[model samples]
Target: MFDLRMWFRALQIIPRLSKDEWDRLDLVSRWLIATRAAVFVMTIVSAGIGGILAARDGHFSGLNFLACLIGLVFAHATNNLVNDLTDHLQGVDEGNYFRAQYGPQPLEHGLMSVRDVLRYTAITGAIALAAGVWLVAATGTAALGLMLAGVVFVLFYTWPLKHIGLGEPTVLLVWGPLMVGGTYLCTAGQWSWDAALIGTAYALGPTAVLFGKHTDKLPADRAKGIFTLPVLLGEPLARRCVTVMLVLQLLAVVTLVWRGALGWPLLVVLAALPLLRDTAAVFARPRPETCPPGFPKHIWPTYLVAYAFRYNRRFGLLFLLGLLIDLALR
Candidate 1:
């Protein structure tokens, strides 16, 4: 296997992981102690969405969930290493010590050698690609295409492709729909509107991530000549766009209802009250409280709202608990 060969190679570097390079591992952030949790949450959300869709059809595909989860973790972790390396190469992440210390960027702070980043990316990416191929072979060719597109998106987003004003959308579209769709297909064994509607909840998660990150890094972005959505769209237009996005999200549920994609059993999924409230909070601030208002920028995705909307895996627990109650009371 690709992984076994790498471990054998590490044997050649037996003394490499010595105390001299202990600081090298500082590249990955340890502040939250929950990087794996984030990955797990995403995997579960993927499987959960698949499960809900399968439930709609009166059948379930557990093997597909497992296969998709495995493939997703490998791909997500590979994307992390790629992003870390690309950010370091582009000068966008070198000085951001907090990002290096707290985010998964091991290369920025020398936590892992540049060699480590490269080696791990190759090994991990190969593993992800292999898993994806295996899933596609057993399931359908569509899964393979999804995985391939994912890699292309991540590569372009972190490197040459991210240089434009469109990085934010590409990131979300990659993180949200691609992952959701691929994972759903692994389980459902086919595509349907139910899967898309289920995936739609998760699709919002990445926007929250991008907006949250943008709010925090507006200064860094402007300094670096990065024209994010807020920067390109301007404050008023940006806020208006976000409002419309929220309204459209609500309308999706209605449209789904009309199309019978959503059964009445889960009709109450309509009550994402916090999402609505947070959308309003974004409109409350015209500009970053820390930055002056007249500048060509605004800060709507405040940390308060960002963290609030973050796709916490624990939310999956609440979702499962709610499902249990619904089943028990029924």
Candidate 2:
């Protein structure tokens, strides 16, 4: 019998499945857990921002919108699979690496074999590429170019990009101008600097989440000779950087309102101020080695990233809601 409960849990949290439980999971559930589907909401938000912005601009296609969302989500899932596979092959995820401690690293944790994970990656990547191809055919050369750029990021991100302290910045670019702007191009069939700019505002949320994850893993990364941004900047400075990004996200929204690109409804994102404030407070301090009180016990070994993810979900939803209202009013 398909375990609907496990399926839902996998969608919401990276469930730590035992060997038998892992075996019992259906293929869809297995893929969901392997791809870290819980975080796929970020990509969905980025796609929604792009599609909604395109609609507001009076150039929206339902086909294009669906293609963009599916393509981005599959691309993100492929990236997650690649990250785990690369780290596993490189031995980066060995010896209880921070990644495996927080969530299932399929290959490293023996939840999946090399062949199994590679099959998953190939299938997911092919679907994303197919969607991109359909989108390019529909939109023309511009969409083709955008698809190529996304492929470059997807292929190289975990290996050289993350290793060279470009991972965090990569997230910003990919989630913001690349995914969102690309969605606009695919759906609107034209470019919009305004769409790109607004997308960047939402982009900061995922960027902050990556910064938090990297910061949380700084020590382990350092010991393993991994040079993530946090390992490069040191934990204290990196945490401060996250705070700066959060502030910039807010500032970006205000600037857009002032420029008349968005309406007062967009200011509703300010409703997320409390969550942002709490996230900033957490980022201001070093991650505790032990589980802090009131922290979710199941999410242990994940500190800053957990808090950042919470803030990102809240802010993203509010931003999307504001954009919807803005669209309705316009």
Candidate 3:
């Protein structure tokens, strides 16, 4: 049966689906889990921020906005599929890899065959490409160029980028300027440096999430010669880097408001400061080898990333709300 509740749960948390449950799940559910749909909200928020900025500037197009949103989300899904496939094929997830410890790795866990996963990737990439083509036809060369950039990131991000020390910075760029600014161009039919700047602020959240995940898997990555940012920086400095990025996120907003790019309404994101404070505290310290007291046992190995995602979700929603109010008043 198609369980809407289960589907929603998967979108919120990476549920550890049993083998029986995986078999019983509907195709949509399987696809959602395989794509790590829980994190899709970040891309949606990035796209929404872009569209809202375009609307405030009197250049929003509903059709183009929808196209950008779908295209980005599908591209993200395709990227996730590609990441899993690359890791599985490389034997990176073969033994006690951190990836399989926290959530299901379809191939590693025997939940899906290689061919089935590739089929999923193909369908998802096709949808994203179709949306990109539509936007390029409707908008212009700018949209085409942005789409090409996104494709490059999608294809190379897992292989050489993540394998090197460029994965974290790639997340920062892709989630920030590339996603938000590109969406603005798709809808507004023009580029805005302001959109790119604002997107950088929100991009910190996802960037921090990736940092945390990489830090969590730093040992595994080092052992396997992955050379992620965390592996390159080492655990202590990497943790400090995440804290610095979070502080920069707030500073970016404050600068925008001061320079008149954003309104005082954007100060409402300060509501997330307390959460950010707690998250910073966590990031300031090394992740515990065992589940800390009161931490959910099921999510033992996923400490920092979970906290980062929670802060990101709250900060993103508040940022969006602030933008909406600012737009309404103007």
Between candidates 2 and 3, the one scoring higher on lDDT is: 3
Residue-wise C-alpha lDDT for candidate 1, range 96-151, written one tens digit per residue = 53244233354554556777678877876787778778788888787777877877
Candidate 1 Cα errors over 4 Å, as ranges: 1-43, 97-104, 175-177, 286-305, 311-330
Q: What is the C-alpha RMSD of each candidate to the true structure, in Å?
A: 8.1, 0.9, 0.8
TM-score per candidate, chains pooled: 0.73, 0.98, 0.99
Candidate 3: 10-residue stretch with minimal lDDT: 12-21
Global lDDT of each candidate: 0.56, 0.91, 0.93
lDDT of 3 by residue, 77-176 (tens): 9999999999999899999799998989999999999999999999999999999999999998888888998999998898999998898889989999
| lDDT score for residue 56 of model 3 | 96
Report the lDDT tens digits of candidate 2 across residue range 53-126: 99999999999999999999999999999989898889999999899998788887788999999999999999
Best by lDDT: 3
lDDT of 1 at 277: 66
